[model samples]
Every structure is written in structure tokens, then in C-alpha cells.
Target: MTRRGATRNGLTRRGVPAVLLDVLLVLVALADTWANVDLGQQPAVSCALLGSFALLLRRRLPLTTFLLTVPTAMVSDAVFATLAALYTLASLSRHRVLLACCALTYAIIDFLPWPWSTLRANELSGTHNVVHLIYAVATAAAPVFLGQLVQARRELSLRLTEITEAREHERLLTAQGVLARERAQLAREMHDVVSHQVSLIAVQAGALQVSSQDPEAKRGAAAIRRLSVQTLDELRHMVSVLRASGSRPTELTPQPSLADLQRLVDGSGMEAELKTDLPEGLSPPVQRAVYRTVQEALTNVRKHAPGATATVRLHHVNGRVEVTVTNTAPTRPPLPLPGAHHGLLGLRQRAELLGGTVTAGPTPDGGYELHLDLPREGAG
Candidate 1:
């Protein structure tokens, strides 16, 4: 069963047994009172019946039951009154109700005399002895004490349940937060890769327009368009993989790795020089992280550094993979702009999630540098 269903079932199981026991107690108390009081004693028998029935519903209506049964028991001297008072004092909704019930019970029983009064000189001491007062007080007080004990136990159980539920809620929220962060990182990656491919298509398409007479140029432009379209389809498929969870279907997929770094270098065409030193068999996630870091770094170089030559370096060392991309600064400084840099921030966040780090800043030799590190397999 689900957790909620199991909890509810457990409560029902515990309560049903307690209710049955209470009903049996009521029956016993009623039988004993009826046997003790003669049928001629109308007031005592009526009181016994009222108090016994009240015990049956004490859990549901504790305060009312206590009030109704207390007065009748004092008059009739019935056992049912004692039991009902106990149930009320222990199980009532609040301390105020319990206190009120206790005071009312004592007042009712104290006012009524026992089986005989001192005024009747012929009456035996056994009929109106100190024992009657002790018995009456003990019976009335016992239920209240029992009720308090039960209340304490119930409160403890409730607090424990609240603590358990809070922890479960926190766990669920943490999982959802993690999933949201992963989705955002994926979006950033998709933007970088897809934008680079689309930019190539646009550049090639523009060249074809200006050099319409050159057949070779037109053919190259058409090829770039087709390649961009194919890559877009694959990008969509990868995004689908992210959004779904199940057994993955195998296919001939061209996932970018160190080999593809050459293509990117060629595409940049001397805007930057790419030097890679990847191990023989890196995990797919590490490979992807490496490829994305390079792509984003180079893209930034193209946009910000312009004519400034940049160098890309990667190496595996000391249970970690390190990447450093450095580019010489331009002779003239660029103007500082206002808006935040989301691209680099997103890249750093992605790196941190993999237990890695990214550092980017100006170098001593009038150049900009970005460094990244990914923890090696089994080095967590």
C-alpha cells in the first residue's frame, strides 16, 4: 500500500480494538450495578443505565458524557459514572474541558450522602462509613488520571508523526530542486551547441548569396544547410532522451567527443588553436562535459576576444581532468557593459554539479584564461 494508506489502516486497526474493549467494560459495569441495586430503587437504577451508556461514547463525546454521567452516578452511586469520568478526564479535547469535568464530578458526588445518613440514628455505620467517601473519590479521580496518561501518549505519538512527515516532505522537495537544476543546465548546453551549428549555416548561406556565379560555393552552402538540419534533428532527440525515463533504445548516434574537437577547430579556422589531451576511455558524461566546456569557451573567444589569438589545452592528471583556454588580450580595452553574463555563470553551475570548478579571469601576460576541472572516475 501507499504510505498514506498504510498509516490510515494502522490507526483504524489500533482504534477498533480499543473501542471494543471499552464496550465490554461498559457491559460489565452495567451488569454489576443492576445486580447490586434492587428494582425498587428507581433513582439508582436509572443513574446506572445513563452512566453505562455514556461510557460507550466517551471517546467521541468526552465532555458531554462526563457531565451527563457524573450527576446520575452521585445520586445512584453507580460504577458507570466513575468510568465515564475517567474517560473524559483522560481523552477530552483540552485541559480546560478535563478540569471542568473533574470539578463537576467531585461537586456532584460530595453533595449526595452514601446509602445512609448520620441523621438516621438507627442506620449502621457500614452504610454511611468513611469507605464510601474514599470509594467515591477514587472512582471519580481514576478516570481523570487515566485520561491524562492516555493524552500524554497520544501527544507524543502525534509529535513523532509530524517529525517523520516533515522529513519526507523535505526529501521530496530536494529531489525536485535537483531535477530542475539539471533541466536548466541541459537548456544551456542545447543553446550553445545548436547556436553554433545554426551560425555556420547562416554564414555559409550568406556566402552563397554573394557568390551566386561560383558553383562550388553554391554546392558548399547547400551541404552546410543539410548538415545543420541533420544536427538539429539529433539535438531534438537528445532533448527527448532527457525528458523521458525508461529503457533506452540503442541507435547509431553521433555524440560529440574529443574527435569532434578537430571539426570545431577547423570551423573556427585560426580564430583559435585547439590542443586536446584526453584519455583513451573517458565516461560519456565526462566526455560531454569536456566538449561543452570547449564549445562555450571558444564561442566566448569569438565574441569577446575577436582578433586576439586563443589557445585551448586539456589534460588528465591526478584523478581529475583539467581544461585551460587562454587568449591574448587586444591592444585596446573594450567598454564594460551592464547586463549580467548568464553564459559563463551557467557553465560554472554545470561544472559545480559534477563536483568540478571553473576559474576565468585576466592572466598576468595581458591575456584572458578559463580553467575547468572534473573529478576523475571513483575519485568522488
Candidate 2:
């Protein structure tokens, strides 16, 4: 047999196959009917048989099955089927009124004589009949109360399972949030510490290249400066990717500002000029956006437009800060370089986050221009 078939054959809830348990209950009901039913009474025998067999339908039609078995309890002493059916109904139904009515009907039917004509008013007042009636009522209530207890236990188990799953999901989300924050912290450190130190290296290399008299020393210094700039570019890309993983905002330390624009242009290795008449005390985010825009524009010019001279212009007018980076056409063929191609996209995203816009395109004269415009107060 397959594993599923074996499981069906095996013990279910309390070490008894569900199908076997049903069959055993049916056999017990049949036995009860045979023991109590009078074979000479055709109607009584028929009702006993009908009630015994109606147990099969209890799961699908609990109320109908219970009503079918009520005739057996009314006419004969066979009451196992009626009690079983009542229990099934109570377990499945949520209506207390309906269950109470069914239980009361069973109790009254079992208490009174089968033939209405034989039940005299004086017999109802007899001590033996009163005690028997109480016993019948208690018997009928037993199965109903037991069924309700089982139903309550089942509902409680389901509720507990749901609570457990919810807690596990919350724990997973908390762990993921912690991981994201750590990644953002690491990215910030790389940007503020590693990137800054590398930029200084590149600047020193450029200075050495200019002052050194030997041609070999100048070549070495230029190579160091070029490689350092490339490393800085890659680091910037990594930082952007890492920061994107975190949903919550975190403050980045040692933020670059407009004051760093002159130093950036001087260290870019290309002939670049910075012209700005902007006022001081601008928001840090606004200054950083403008600075990153200029940096990315200069990097792209070096990569794709070799020997190009660039100009950066920054100004604030009419409650808006506008930055424009224009570069002349290349003087020679540019070298093929490896890149993630995310620089311009990152700049545009940064501008958007700060309530700004970035637009870049090639000029009619074969030059390229990038423009960034931002609100004076940045995004609220």
C-alpha cells in the first residue's frame, strides 16, 4: 500500500482508524437496536433499523440524521443511534438554541410512553416516572456537553497555531531589519573613511606627478592617480548598492558639501573649472547632491571623453539651486573601461529623493551636459 493508504489504515485521533471507528460505532448501534427492538412489532423494528443505519449520514447531515434516529428513541428502547447523532450535531453546529431544542426533544421522547393513549396524566406524577425522566434528561445532556467541549478544544488548537506562525514571521522580519541596518552602517564607513583616504592618495599622486622632474617618476605618479580614482569610483558604486538595501533612513557622517567642490575639481586630473556664486548655509543633502552630480559628471568625462575640459557652475535663484556640468568634446579616442553603468542613474535617484531632477545629454557640438535642479530646503 502507498504511504497515504497506510496512514488511512493506521490509527487516527486516539489510535483508531477513522473508518474502523465509524464501523465499530455502527456495529454497536446495530447491537443496541437488536437487543431493544421487538421483532413482532413491524413499525418498531423498522424504525430501529433505520436509526441504526442513519449513523453513516451523521457527518454529512447531522440534523437530518438526528431527526431520523428520534423515531427509534420514541418507539423503542434503542437510543444509541439518537445519542450519537445528537453528539455529531452538537460538535458541528454553532447554534446553542438548536442544540438545546434537539436535546430537549430527545429527553421528552425518551421519557413519555410510546403510545400517547397509554400515557395517563397520573403516570407523569408518579415517583418512578419522575426519576426516570430525570435520568433520561441527564443521559441526553451528556453527549451534547461532551461534543461542545471537543469543539472548543479544536478551536483553541487552531488559534494557538495561528499565534505561533505570526510570532515566527515577526521574528524573521526583525532579523532582516537588523541585517539591513548593519549593511548600511558598513557602507557609510566605506564612504566616509575608505573613500576619503583614497581621494587624498589620488590628490598626492597628482601633485607628485606635477613636481617630479624624472619622466619615469611622473609616469608612476600618473598611474597611481588613475588607479586610485578608479578605486574610488568602484567604492562609490558599492556604497550606493549597500545603502539601497536598507529601507529605514540613516544619517551618513562627514557629508561632503559645496565647500568640497573646489577640491574635487582640482583632483579630477582633467582641466576643470568651478564657478559658483551660491550663498552659504544650504542644507547638507542639497550640497551633497550637487557635489555627487559634479563628481559623477567628471568621472564620466574621464572615462568616456578623454582629454575633455569640464566646467561646473552652481547657483541659487528663485528658491531653487541649479547645478550644471558642461564638458568639451574629447581631443582623442577614449579607452574602453569597465563600469557598472550605475553612476548617472544613481545621481538621478539621489536628486529625486531630495525633491530634485537630473537631466543629461550630448550637446550639438559633440560635448555633454548634465543639469541638476533642487529645492532650496530639499525634500521635507
Candidate 3:
């Protein structure tokens, strides 16, 4: 069952026992009053029995129960049931009706016979009956006041429960959304791993054709390379998702920026010259995009141009940050690398996401260059 439904069912199940308890208590009180009281003795006792029965519907029809018990309290010894009804009404915030009902109960208890014996004594002695009337009024008011105060506390508790439930539901939704994004990312990672292995197979086939002089081997190698590249292009989007998602942190943490650029270069274990004039106060996303751009550029040069020397430049000017990576041509012939050539594409996607652009190609002086320009403000 849904949470609210379960809560309501729980209330009903608990309420049944409480209703039975109230009926039992009211009946016991009536039996005690019937044995002792002597005011309007017959009518009072019969009406008290009827009013106690009315208490059964207190939760469902509190007003009806109160109306039935109030008249009975005037003549009957059923004051206990009437007082219970008054409290129920007050707790429900029915102050206006309770005022009228309480006024009548006070008048009945004071003017009508409290027990007929007291009324007869006051009549015979000609006493003012001041103390009894005052006592009766106070008795009527006590439970109503208590009920109102208790009702305020109950309402406050209910409000707090609702607020807590809403916050918990919101947290659940947020966690589900994060899990969904993570699953999409994991799928992409699997694709990249598989595609890179296939690219290596294609690369080895090409190398085999070069080393051997057999025409059949050459033709097979050419076919493998062509088919592998085609498949890579077809699954380009999935590979792109993997390349971008793999760089992200799975937990909340400070994102990498230009400050981390040197660490990135050093971690690669590549001998490359680095330069930086990057400005401070860039947004986190822009910083991450810039850092990833440079990182991808260097990694690509290492993959495609082995044994090449590389130079990286970072510049900040006119509310924009520009990073460029340039590398000299490899002295040795190109060797097959287990990379899918998707790094540059991922960099392009990241830069564009920040409303920027990336340019990468072979340089004129027997080298390759990758350039990225990102604006600092409104770059989200």
C-alpha cells in the first residue's frame, strides 16, 4: 500500500479499540451515578443510558454525540458522558457551539437539581446557592479548556509529520535520478572498452599487412581496417558517452581546473613542455571543460604520434580562457594504440556544452595542434 493509505488504515485499526474503551468507561460511570444520585431520578437514569450509548459515534459524529449528552446531563446523572462530549468538541476546534452547550450545562447543573437533595436543602433554608453555581461553571469549563490546548499540540504534531514525509519523498526522487544517470554512464563505459579492443585488432591487421609481402594478407588487412573503422563510426555516440562520462567523479567533490593541469601532465608520465597564464575566478564547469580539453589533447598526441615532443599553452584574456596543445611529428613510424580516437570528440562536446569551441588538426610544421576557447562568464 502507499504510505498515506497505510497511515489511514493504521489510524482506523487503532481507533476501534479506543472507541470501545470510551463506551466501557461511560457505561461504568453511569452505573455508579445511577446507584447514588436522587435528582429527577427516573428520567435522569434513562436519559443517561441513552447518552452513554451516543458516545460510540464520538469520532465519526462528535457534534451529534455532544448534543445528545448535553440534554441528558440536565436531568440525568450522566454528567460524565456529557463532559467527554464537550472535550471532544473542544479538541475538534468547535469553540462557538461548545460555548452555547457549556452555558446550558452550567445552568442545568446549578438551577436544576444537582442531586435533588441539595436543591431541597437550599429551598428549605433559603440559601443563595452561590458556591454550588460557581463550582458547576468551573467544572463545565475545565475539560473544554484542556481539550483546546491538547488539540493545538495534536495539530502541530500532524504538521511536523507531513513536512518530514515530504522531505523524505523528495530525497528518494533525487537519488533515483542520480542512479539513472549513472547507469547510462556505465553503459557508455562498457561500449568504449569493447570498441578500443576492436580498434586494436584492426590496427594489428594493418601492421601484419605491412610486415608481410603476401597479397592475400594485404587484402585481408585492408578489409579488417575498413570494417572496424565503419563499425566505430556507427557506434560513435555510445563511444562518445563513455569517453565523457568516464572523466566524471561518481561522488560529490571539488572539480579539477587549471590548478590541476600540471598534475595531469605529470601523471601521464609524458615529457612535455607546459605554459600557463590562466586567470582566476572561472566557474567550475568552465574550469573542468578547459582542464579536460588540455588533458585530452596531450593524451591524443601520445596515442597517435608516439615518440613526439609536445608543448601546451594556457592563456586568459578578454573574459576568455584559451588552451592549446601542439606536438612535433613522431620520429618513429606510427604504432597501433588501444585507443578509439574518441578523445578529441569528447573534448569538442565538453567545450560546446560550455558555449565554447575546439579546433584540432595537423600543424604545418610537421606537428599536430589542439585549441580550445572558453568564456568565463555565463559559460554554463
Candidate 4:
């Protein structure tokens, strides 16, 4: 059972509230006192009463309470108060020597008669007195044994609860380890099978486009090559994301940086110009965000604004990096293309993570412009 459930069950088994239990013990002690001690014996009666009431302090000061009840046990026949105090002390205390001494003290006190100088030696030698002394020792040891058993049970329950929780945590970690391994295996398959085939398709398309005589055939081959290349790029990104799952943040394969920006623009198969005058030594995240923003903007322009020229500019100003991609009006209508439409949304999210922003809108001259601004420190 859960720890909370066990605690609730313990409370249910107890049945009586602590205050009521204390009151009940006090009443039992008082009844024992009245039955054992005579009213006329003033000193014995007073000690009996004091010990009976002292049961109320057993939970808080068990040793002191046990000591207080010793006087009554010695002077009168009343024993309920002393037994209760002894049991409480045994349950709460860990010192074997202390408990042993307390039990021995109780046994001696209960066995010896009052006014010890009167007839002690002769009485102790009698068979009846010897049996009575044995009975008193047995009674004292009873409570101590019972109290120690109760303490051991309580500790065992807590230890079981800790073991249960540790096993549950281990089970969760094992499940996650299995999932991470599966993802890694899937990533390797995609890279080896799907990416390799797409690369071959792009290469074949490039060869066909170069060798074709008909303009229409060449255009078709070029389109096929470009689309294949784009698909390969997307497949690589997806594989990287998959491999990164359940792991620490890592650099994506073919990790993009500002140095790759020129190659990206040149390979985009569009009339695009790149201009940058930014400082060196930018953080990786900042450079990556800039590269992805330019890549996405150039892709959109190629797909949606055919025959339009694009200008890419980047610079640093006021401790911030700024990037803008602007494209003129399309000379021909854009062809229908299938897209998940998450490119700009993803760019914005990446920018936000680096304390940056991405904004896109139409310019006054019937052109589209995309802008990205990032802090130089990159979310430090």
C-alpha cells in the first residue's frame, strides 16, 4: 500500500483519539489505585493518586512519568500507572541499558514490602514471597517486550514503503531507456535507406537536366532535381530531431552557421544576392537562427514568387543582429505546392528562444519582406 494509505489504516485501527485514550488510561489507573490502597493510609493514597494522574504525561515525558509512578508501586499495590509508563518508555527509547535498568527497578519495587526494616529477611526466604517476586519480574518484562515489538513493526513498515518507491522509479527509467534506443535505431534506418535513395535521385535528375536538348525536358529535370534536394534537406532535419529525442540538446548534423550562408544562397537556384557586415564570434544558437531564417525565406520566395529576384542583408546594430530578405513581385503565378505550412512558425519559435523576433509582411512596392532581430548575447 501507499504510505498515505498505510497511515490512514493505522489511524482507523487505533479507533480512539489520543485525548480519549489518555483519559481512559487515567481512569483505569485511578480504579486500580482505589482498589489497592486504603483511604486511611494518607501518604500511600496521595502517592497512588499522583501516579494515576501522571499517566497523562507518559507520551511527552515517558521516563519522568515512569519515575513518578515508581513511588506508588513501591508504597501501594497499585500498578496500572507504573506499567503504562514503563510500556510508553520502552516503545520510545532505544537504549537497551536504560530499558533493562528501568524494568529491573520496577521488578524490585513491586516485590519489596513497605517499611523494609520490619521483617524483610524472613519474608523473602518464604516460598510464597519467592513466588510473588517471580510474578512481579514477569509482569515488568511483559510490557517491555510488547513495546519493543510495536517499535520494530513501525520501522519495518517505513522501510517497505521506501523500497516500493525506489522500484517504481527504476521501472520508469527502464521504459525511457527502451524508447530512446528505438528512436536511435529508426534514425539510422532513415539516414541509410531514405536519405541515400533521395541523394541518388537528385544526382540522376541533375545529369538528365544537363544532357537534355529540349527546353521543356530540361525544365522538368531541373524542377525534379530541386525538389529532390529540398526533400533530402527536410529528411535530414527530421532525422536529427528524432535522434535528439530523450537526450541532451546537441548540434544538428551538418550544423549550420553563418559560414554556410553563402553556399545556401548559391544553391537555392534563384536570383538572390547576399550581403553581410556582421562581427565575428557570435554564439552558435544566434548564428543557427540567422541561417535558418535566411534559408526559410529564400525557400518561400522560390516556391511562391517564381521569376522574382531576392536580396538578403544582415548586419549588427545597437548590440543586436538584424537580418532581412526581400523579394520583388512575381512575373508568373506560383505553382501549387504541398507544404505543412510550419516553416515561418518554426522560425519564430527558434528566434524567440534566443531572445529574438521574426516578422514578415508585404512591402509598399508589392514585394514581400521577412525580418529577424536577435540579441548579440543570444539568450545568455
lDDT at 191, model 2: 92
Considering TM-score, where higher is better, how would the candidates rank from best to worst? 4, 2, 3, 1
| Deviation of model 1 at 302, angstroms | 36
Name model 1 segments beyond 4 Å from true.
1-25, 56-60, 75-77, 96-136, 193-227, 230-380
Q: Number of clashing pairs, model 1? A: 3
Candidate 4 lDDT (Cα, whole model)?
A: 0.88
Query: Taking the tens digit of each residue's C-alpha lDDT, what string does model 3 give over 196-226?
Result: 8878987897798798799867865776676
Compose the digit string of candidate 1's lDDT tens values, residues 284-341: 6677777888888876765676467888898889879998989888644554545467
Error of 1 at 209 (Å): 14
Off by over 4 Å in 4: 1-161, 177-185, 188-193, 196-200, 214-254
* Ranked by lDDT, top first: 4, 2, 3, 1
Q: How big is the positional error of residue 346 in model 3, measured in Å on the Cα after superposition?
A: 31
lDDT of each: 0.68, 0.88, 0.72, 0.88
The lowest-lDDT stretch of 10 consecutive residues in candidate 2 is 1-10
Model 1 weakest lDDT span, ten residues long: 1-10
